[model samples]
Target: MTHTTLSTAQRDRAAGVLLGLACGDALGAGYEFGAPLPDHTPVRMQGGGGFGWAPGEWTDDTSMAIPLARAAAAGLDLRDETVLDGIVAQWVDWAKTAPDVGVQLRAVLSRTEPTASAVRQVAKAHHDRHGRSAGNGSLMRTAPVALAYLHDPAALAEAARLVSSLTHYEADAGDACVLWCLAIRHAVLEGELDLRIGLPALPADRRALWEGRFAVAETSRPADFARNGWVVEALQGAWSAIVTTPATDATHLRLALDAAVRGGRDTDTVAAIAGGLLGARWGASAVPAEWRRIVHGWPGLTAADLLRLGSSATPDLAHAQAESVDYAYLGDVSTLVRHPHDDGVWLGAAGALDALSAEIDAVVSLCRVGTKQVPTRIRHRVEVRLIDDDDPAKNPNLDVVLLDTVQVVAALRAEGHTVLLHCAQAQSRTPSVAALYAAVHRGVPIDRALAEVIAALPAAAPKRFLRDAVVRLAEANTDSPHQGPNTEGARA
Candidate 1:
């Protein structure tokens, strides 16, 4: 199936599929198979489940999905027999010594040859003997199938079933994959959560049945689905967590997944299932920087690898160029100045790294920099993906990225580390982010913060888009309850 070019919003949502999956998987890895926690309890990725997972480490749910994501990233048609066979081969290889594998999937994969046909036959025969093969295993890894056929719902439905059938032969399992994949596709394109959008794609006989299941999900809590090991209940549990949660913005993505994890048994699988759809709706920007910094899993992949794979899987995403930059024309790239509101923070261009004082122990980079741009001695270095362009489309998650970047700086400073914040030139991204940091963390008015920051850096001139975002964030912050640095008598 051919796909047309995607808008920036569409691209971000598309890239979020696997990213959200990994975040949910890792967050819930530590709490798997436990009873539901009391409401309002904090959920963290402090790993140590039945399988000893490291903090921020994903389990088999994401591990199983990686092969499909890799294939989609390679531009292969997911429904093609050759592609399916290759996916099966990868799964077989992964199961050899993987730390964790689902019981149903391990049974099917262990008995069959690595080929697609062999796996399908063995799966069907196993189902025939057991009279049931509707484990949630297949549904947990079905997120990537949506990325391959974002524009072709019919093909997506067919591919989802075919892929699920490779290890799960039950109709319920196939139907669940079809619904979830279609929901992900719709979420990516429309930025809304509507699972019923896929109902027409399912067989007419099964439409009402699934609709009723969705109705039950809406009325129930995630813990209501006690038999979550079954694919039907798993879908219900995931959907319940999503609908029951209230969100005013993209933070819904994190809160809903927290709801899923708190639902108890099979925590990782349920949360991973919800995360794919949440990521599709909110884009990668909605994910927290703290979580993105550490989430890693199978085959030695990090969050950045997942971002690349997700972006590559979607067609027509405009990637930023990695061409070498000429800093000589920009006059002085090394003009360093202390933040007007906080003495702990330093502001400058990328060139400021050349003569960093020993006091600067943390670095927050806003633009692309060389691998060795920051000194190795700086133990805490964060790279924020903020483009200098004024077009909103150029930076799809502009506001979220800005807020997250400043939060990173705030976090570093709260740890008592002096920080150096910089971009390519002190003109656009650097000044804008510095101003935001002052407004957010020092409790200074944004306009005053911008003026003070611009005064400190003679070359500072923020982009129109960034300036507008700063104003919006400042107004929003004023309305919300916030605790920042004690600025009672601090310098403006």
Candidate 2:
């Protein structure tokens, strides 16, 4: 692979914005309510804090930011209902089982409106019923908006405020979002922190309010900023940590993370806020490698995944393409490519028929995970829900269901039918099932079969969850006789 001419600092800050947020969130997870951490060594992701999250697992802060980052990366207009609807969908889905959710956020998310105006009304209603409406929930997840609009300072400010109104309509919450996003954008684009640049984006009345706050941030301890749920206090705590810590040393990010967690209240959010600025100033590489390896979130995104996502959010790197299918064979088994696996049967995208041979005897569709879509064009159609790892929690019988479909594929091959397994993209689902069939029915070892499958399909990468599921099923039935198939290796 060739490298882009982009500077190392540019790449680092780009990936840093999101990865930093996750690192801080995970690092502070276990210390949310505990005694303040010492400022000597940096905080680690030692799970079992107030939320009982696993080590390196982030919370709602990073989870809620994902859809926004994806939204900005796709260039969706934030003012549009479709864009807001996408954000709402991710929020609702996460809230379904989120271990922690703020009271006002819960009420606002409960309403099924996709418009910013509607969400604002819902938030106002919640505030009327409850006590306070302004919380750090909105600001905690606002860092991605900065990455999404890194080049345009004005647009970035506008988006930061608009997105905040989704659940936090208070002007201070919106102003905090604007200030933090501008700070992140500056750090990402200019490689330094300049909180003053966001002043023009804030409401004229609130300008004086933030000026005094910034002065306090420069000299105060993180504890003086208060780790409460209030948005102003959240920004104060996060910025105090950022400004007080020395950003010059090689371990500047570590010092900042330590300061944010030292307060011991709302540790995750405060650290997350500080992480964004620190990451923006330093770059993703500034975060400790040990912490990066373990940091993950509800979106199934590890720090590495988030780094890739953040880098992709850069405007010069963004591109749009129509879906195309590539054809290859996993040993004797044929493969068709898509996003998720297609149960090792021949399936093509809507316009990828050119690459796929029109002479296919059968097709198995495993797109959409749980919902099986039976094919009508092919003579023999096998439906299998070989879902990705993300869906396993929702569908517990995924392994058994996949095993049954593998047997069915073996049976079809024995009956002398050439087949193609396809999913939405054939990237993970289709290739995984193809490799599994090679291992189980064709007597190939799992590793060798996987190597062959990926080698044959250069575009395909292994999906560990699907592969493990298939391997577990294969190991369970290893002692049983192979009675379904007719050949030593069934050719698809």
User: In model 1, which regions exceed 4 Å deviation?
Assistant: 318-399, 415-420, 443-448, 475-492
Summarize candidate 1's per-residue lDDT along 1-492 as a digit string, tens digits: 477478777877888899999999999999999998877899998999989999989999999999999888777998899999999999999999988899899998898789999999999998999999999999999999999988799999999999999999999999999999999999999888999999998999999999999999999999888889899999999999999999677778889999999899999999999999999998877777778767999998877668768887865752422233446577889889999899999999888988999999988878765545678798677767677887766676677788888898898899899999998888888878888888888888876787788878868877777777887887787653333432232233
The whole-model lDDT of each prediction reads: 0.86, 0.69
Could you tell me every candidate's TM-score relative to the true structure? 0.88, 0.63
- Per-residue CA lDDT of model 2 for 342-441, tens digit only, reads 3334434322333456556665555421211223355555434344555443333455456655666677667676666666555666667776777678
- Model 1 weakest lDDT span, ten residues long: 481-490
- lDDT for model 1, on a 0 to 1 scale? 0.86
Model 2 Cα shift for residue 434 (angstroms): 38
RMSD of each: 4.2, 14.2
